[model samples]
Target: MELELRHLRTVRAIADTGSLTKAAAALGLAQPALSAQLRRIEKALGGSLFERDHTGARATPLGELVLERARVVLPAVSELQAEAVRFANATGALDRFRLGGTHGPLLGGLVDRIAAAHPVAPVSTYTAWSVDEIASMVIDGRLDFALIGACGESPPPLAERLTWEVVGVDPVFVMLPEGHELAGEGELELASLADESWANVPGDGCFEECFATACARAGFAPVSVFETDTASVVHLVQVGRAIGLCRATFPPTPGLVTRPLAGAPLSWRHLVGWHPRSPAASAAAVTVTGATRAAYAEAVSRSPSYARWLTSHPRFGTVA
Candidate 1:
């Protein structure tokens, strides 16, 4: 009845697919075997992990708490296993690299570069919703590097222990309905948008903090509504229910347009950090920085509106 990595993974698979049958198929196990494992996990954890319906399973409140922690634990465990294999191979060289990233354009770009440079080395990625969580993994040696977005002159706390580099600065853009009165203009001042409701997820990089801080400076406190669903955020913006903060890296969406915030109150500095204990941490950081900039360049090409904004403002917005 003891919980192990396998049990945690079972929870993840079920939560992800939302069905016992699908989770079992994904893990190459019979449904009955997977069902039995769930029972054992529940016994060990002292509660049912999921509330099942005819359609599928969903985490209970207790299950939600465990699943959240399990996300972090699973990545670290996966990296640990990979490292053990490298040592077992006895070549004294890593067969692959591991990385974790908060939401941003740099991730896609960095992965592309790593595969090209280390064709033989396998690369694995894990997506985290917050920089703080990503920092934990970097400290644990689970990730060789982490890409974080910070505001103003602040560096994430882990910077002191790791080799950190500023890859580039991403200017925060305001996305709203295409037909909105303000969208007719090419740029906007944060103060003008103060009355608008904001869509934000707490702990999403600097999303909430930057938005609130900027609003305070604008002499108004924005009405913040928590929305974690991407589709909901899109709908709110399109219908003018709320406005959202985004970066140029996000592709153009129909019915929406992005404008630069004049006097940019919420710019985030792109940081790529690696601990010294990781092999070639400094060298890897350098390569990733270059890759990040390249990614932005490609993003501009794919998004004409963003490209125009970037061109009109060669320099990134300074934190207010």
Candidate 2:
């Protein structure tokens, strides 16, 4: 007998459950039937797929290889079936969209635009703090699309698989307490404050490398007095313990003041990325590109931080 989908499914079930009896129960088949299927598959291949031990069934080396291939093949087959069914029902209407992104202030309006554009379509959202995690999820089919920063300062070997499009640009600001000595300065240069203590997020944080790179560009390494992975960097800045950098579009907090970096390369571009081959990804790419453009326009109109940065800086206008 030739290899078939059922044979692959049985192999996966046995590998996952580690017992023929439980695999049969999970598959809604009698133990004898499941055993026969396994035996037939092994015979066709002229080898034993699993080792029967006192405890249960365990996959041999060949069986493990088959299971790995099954994982990729099964998901593709299932998605194809689902896509065909959806096409039949909607006659080519848009289906669900899976999205991932870093947690940043601009995401609020971006999410709003997607919601308004597709009122009835289901959207799945995931927030990733690091670029690698987002890339892995997209490659493994967990996410159809993601919005991420280009990896350079944070880590090496960036998410190189997905196609990326720049959507928005924002300046990095130095967040300080209201009564701090640097608060009086109109624009703070990184070199002017290199001697000051800094507060940083942990290694996997989105801004950690950006902050380090900025300091390095200023010709000095920062002395990180505190390191935590809290969502809000403003909290650390407000306590007067250390100064931190944040995106200019971040909402203003009551006790914090942010000034643009006058000397260092302080701008970061927001990017929209997706797997090239996924049908769902292609659909999401079209919708998000249009929506992000509109959202950037709206942001410039209403957000004071965006208006000031975009109008005064020549490079900011090139985003999107």
Candidate 3:
């Protein structure tokens, strides 16, 4: 809750976008999550940062003061990171691996592969729900690479500045309690769960809107949709509080059953990216992207349901 660079970035984004919803979209955060974060920031700072109404958010006097400082600090920090990376590359000491990613198994799998490939490399990771946040780290030279996902054919963030390679594509799936009536079914029609509540981990892409549109196409709207963390989504599904949506490769969780939505109403694409101008691009861009694709293939091969589904679908799965 302490004042931090990220908080300043949040205030700046809100000020720039003039609306929490728009700022959240730009920052790759859910609107509710961003609002809650703003509330916490206001509490910690002992003042309201912005005047909020249906019209939009407008910065208060205090907000303007913070914005003034953030405008200076954020860019200065970016420059410092750029300089540090330049120094490292010049000295020929750019030997470490730094990665940023959203929540998923693929990041870990890729890390394992990288470690095996370069046993002496000091590898590190940063996790965020926001794809933009991860992408920005790479652009600012704070991280060497970014691993993230987009809904369907949606492109990864800041494509003009970074080189992105496809890892794999996965059909989105629903998680049901093991004893639920649908648990016995191999696949589900989207409309079949019209009355069910939905829960999913927050993501920065169009997946939220995509899900709603798919439900509309299926002829019904969800009764409720809960945007929460991964653990909460699983807990909600396990206790029958809600049905959870996840990547098709979601590992088996006891008391929960994962089933594909028939016709693949929704899908997710995995990608890895790095700033083309950064040392990582020349040093090990191939190594990192290769590890990611290999790791994804290994994951899919181990997922019986996904493997079988991929065989029949053909069009989905590994990008190559």
Candidate 4:
């Protein structure tokens, strides 16, 4: 028989209270109206749903079956109502901010800080491989801000139109497998690996262009065989299949090592960009950008390799 949510709620209430008068009172309905609803349900089912007893009213066999189903159905309906209320509260009241960054160190500490600092507002982060796509998202109002790599040779697109902030610079490192021929070398000269197959981040001009130019300055062009933007490029390097170029602040893992390129110039810089037109963009951008720079600084201070790289190359200073 076809039954509605109100019918199930009425049955549960009657079963709980053990009297139609009490059930109607609990449900905030008139006694006659509640009686009519129960009678209509019983008629539809083609059976008597309750038996009159000295104590009060009790369920018949058909009523017991309906009560069992109502026990399951009523609570589910209540829970759905609660969830609707929660969803409405979350999306309707809280301010939302969207931020995009390259697949690198920019997103690491900023995500946690934003969550802790702004408990009420919702923040979203996206990883983009291409600088052009990130710039487009910011310009089109799809993102409040974007954190991207910038180099002295090729900086990010127009900053005058959009408010730009230089968060930090991530030193580029050459990733190589454990026990590889050059793994034991204290430092690498970029020209030596001219013919070696390289793995690169697809559509990310920062790493690919920087590494290629570094190699060209050392007098050779690298042959890149595989291209991907995943953070696991270090894993590919660890397997000895291909060498990778990655940021210095990459998470530490066993069996992998990053060393400074002895002869190459340090040029990689990370910048945070936001559209001036977005109302919530400045505050959100400041929170994320500040956290990101602080994390990079703390991470570098703790890493011996980063320390050595910095000491060896004094000209490469902190980016604004």
Candidate 5:
């Protein structure tokens, strides 16, 4: 009959939602099950949290006091966990190489290289769609390094505690179906695809805004944009439903082709970051960054069209 963090969270949920049924739904519990749990919690606390009626549940005075304490306790506990991890990492207590990345080709290559170089050391990876999420994990010591991308000239995650370095740069390319009329061309004008609908993987970055600005400079706003996952973007382009924006190194897909825009109006910058205070800052960062650059080169070599395009555009491709 002791109260726990879960009990506090349940109480807070009931207060926030203002109904037992709503709180149950929010907490992913059956209404009856939530009620039973709440009854036990109330008995432990020696008072009911909410006065319930047909209208809805309303927090009593004791509930308000508990809610206030929960607001403090939850965040404190979270910060403590983060600080503990940071301390462990700073003290060299963590022996494994932990990497977090936004969905891309670089992570796998980097992981492979790290594992090969350090056969006895453990290496793990975490992938997410958002660059900021990956960067935050590095800052919180949940990851030793982060592999992410940013739109051209845009800064990496705003955290000052992390050090970010460019691993490579790539002109954003347009993905079209193999049968597309423009697919045969060496390069396409952004304005040429003015009327075409677009699809791209959704993420937290400046890419979407940069795309819109580039299109505006091309003298036409996109007719439609379907924000979705990478697989869906490929499917949309393959079916001729929409064109997709991708890295120049995007691997060749069976039904799709990627061609650079004539003016290189858009570009992606590959970056690797780590908390300067973490174990990765010693020598692992340099090793991983070098591996990532080499990986980018391999990716470019695999994409024949991109490799040929790089030959013509000397300024683009893997960063020095």
Candidate 6:
């Protein structure tokens, strides 16, 4: 007989509660039925899954191994079921479009543009720090389109599979507390931050690579003393805990300031990308591209220094 989800859940319940009676109650099954089910499962595997005693039920070594797999499989199955339910409930949810991108105002703009014009379209939105993460989701059919920020002069490793449009280029700036001496300073050297702690979120993409490379070039390696998300990165810098990087278009956060590096050194080549398989991918790319460009302009308006840097370095976010 094929193993069912209930069989797995029953094993988990028995292991978690450590008592057959409790596990049966938790699973809403009678004690005899649960015991019979466990016996059948154990017989199929040619082993006893649980040991019975006066104290309680204990998983055998084999049972322990099975439970380890259960942890990973259960959650994924739950999410799959949930996603199925959502799509089923929402008519034409996947048929119209889906979008994903890096977090911040640009993502918001991209989502809004698509949603505004096709208000009833079955749309899904997601965000990630790594351009590769966004690109993978697009290629795997999770997202129809993505807007990503690449720090290097070229598209990310997976670019060949998808069409990319550079909506705008954004300079990378060091975010520091307003009270810090280097706040708003023009063209500061990377070495100046060498003595300071860095705050970074774990990412496999340009964020970590660029920080490592640029700091390496500056004759130092950045030590990320704290790992956190975008909002927390802002908070970490605001409290004078650490320095972090952001695109020039990041909206101004209170109690913090952003300064350009002297050489126009590190910036992201922003692109709106999509897999060509979808008939609507080209149209989605246009809407996302325009929204991203407008969002960059809005971000520039919020920071005068960043705008000047963008104006001075016309090739800031371009790839040759």
Ranking by TM-score: 5, 3, 1, 6, 4, 2
What is the number of backbone collisions in each predicted candidate, taken in the order shown? 0, 0, 0, 0, 0, 0
- Compose the digit string of candidate 2's lDDT tens values, residues 86-127: 344331333766778766555667778878888887777898
- Give each model a TM-score: 0.65, 0.63, 0.73, 0.64, 0.73, 0.65
Please write out the lDDT profile of model 1 over residues 1-320, one tens digit for every residue. Answer: 56788888999999999999999999999999999989988988899889999988999998999999999999888768755653343323445767788766668877898899889888889877778778766666666678777765676756666777675666778788988889888779888987788774345445566667778888888766646655677788888889887775568889998888876667667777766655636465666666766765676677777666666676752211
Residues 112-214, candidate 3: write the lDDT tens digits: 9999999999999999999999987787677888999989988789887789998888999999999899899989999999999999989889999999999
lDDT of each: 0.75, 0.71, 0.89, 0.72, 0.88, 0.75
Name model 6 segments beyond 4 Å from true: 1-95, 223-225, 317-320
After aligning candidate 1 to the native by TM-score, how far in Å is the CA of 12 from where it should be?
A: 39
In model 4, the number of clashes is: 0
What TM value does model 4 have? 0.64
On a 0 to 100 scale, what is the lDDT of residue 61 in model 3? Answer: 95
Residue 137 in candidate 2 has what lDDT?
71
For candidate 6, the per-residue lDDT at 75 reads 84
Tens-place lDDT per residue, model 5, 257-310, is 999899899989999898886788887778888999989999999998788888
- Looking at model 6, the pairs that clash are none
For residue 233, what is the lDDT in candidate 4?
Answer: 71
* Best lDDT among the predictions, by candidate number: 3
Off by over 4 Å in 5: 1-85, 89-94
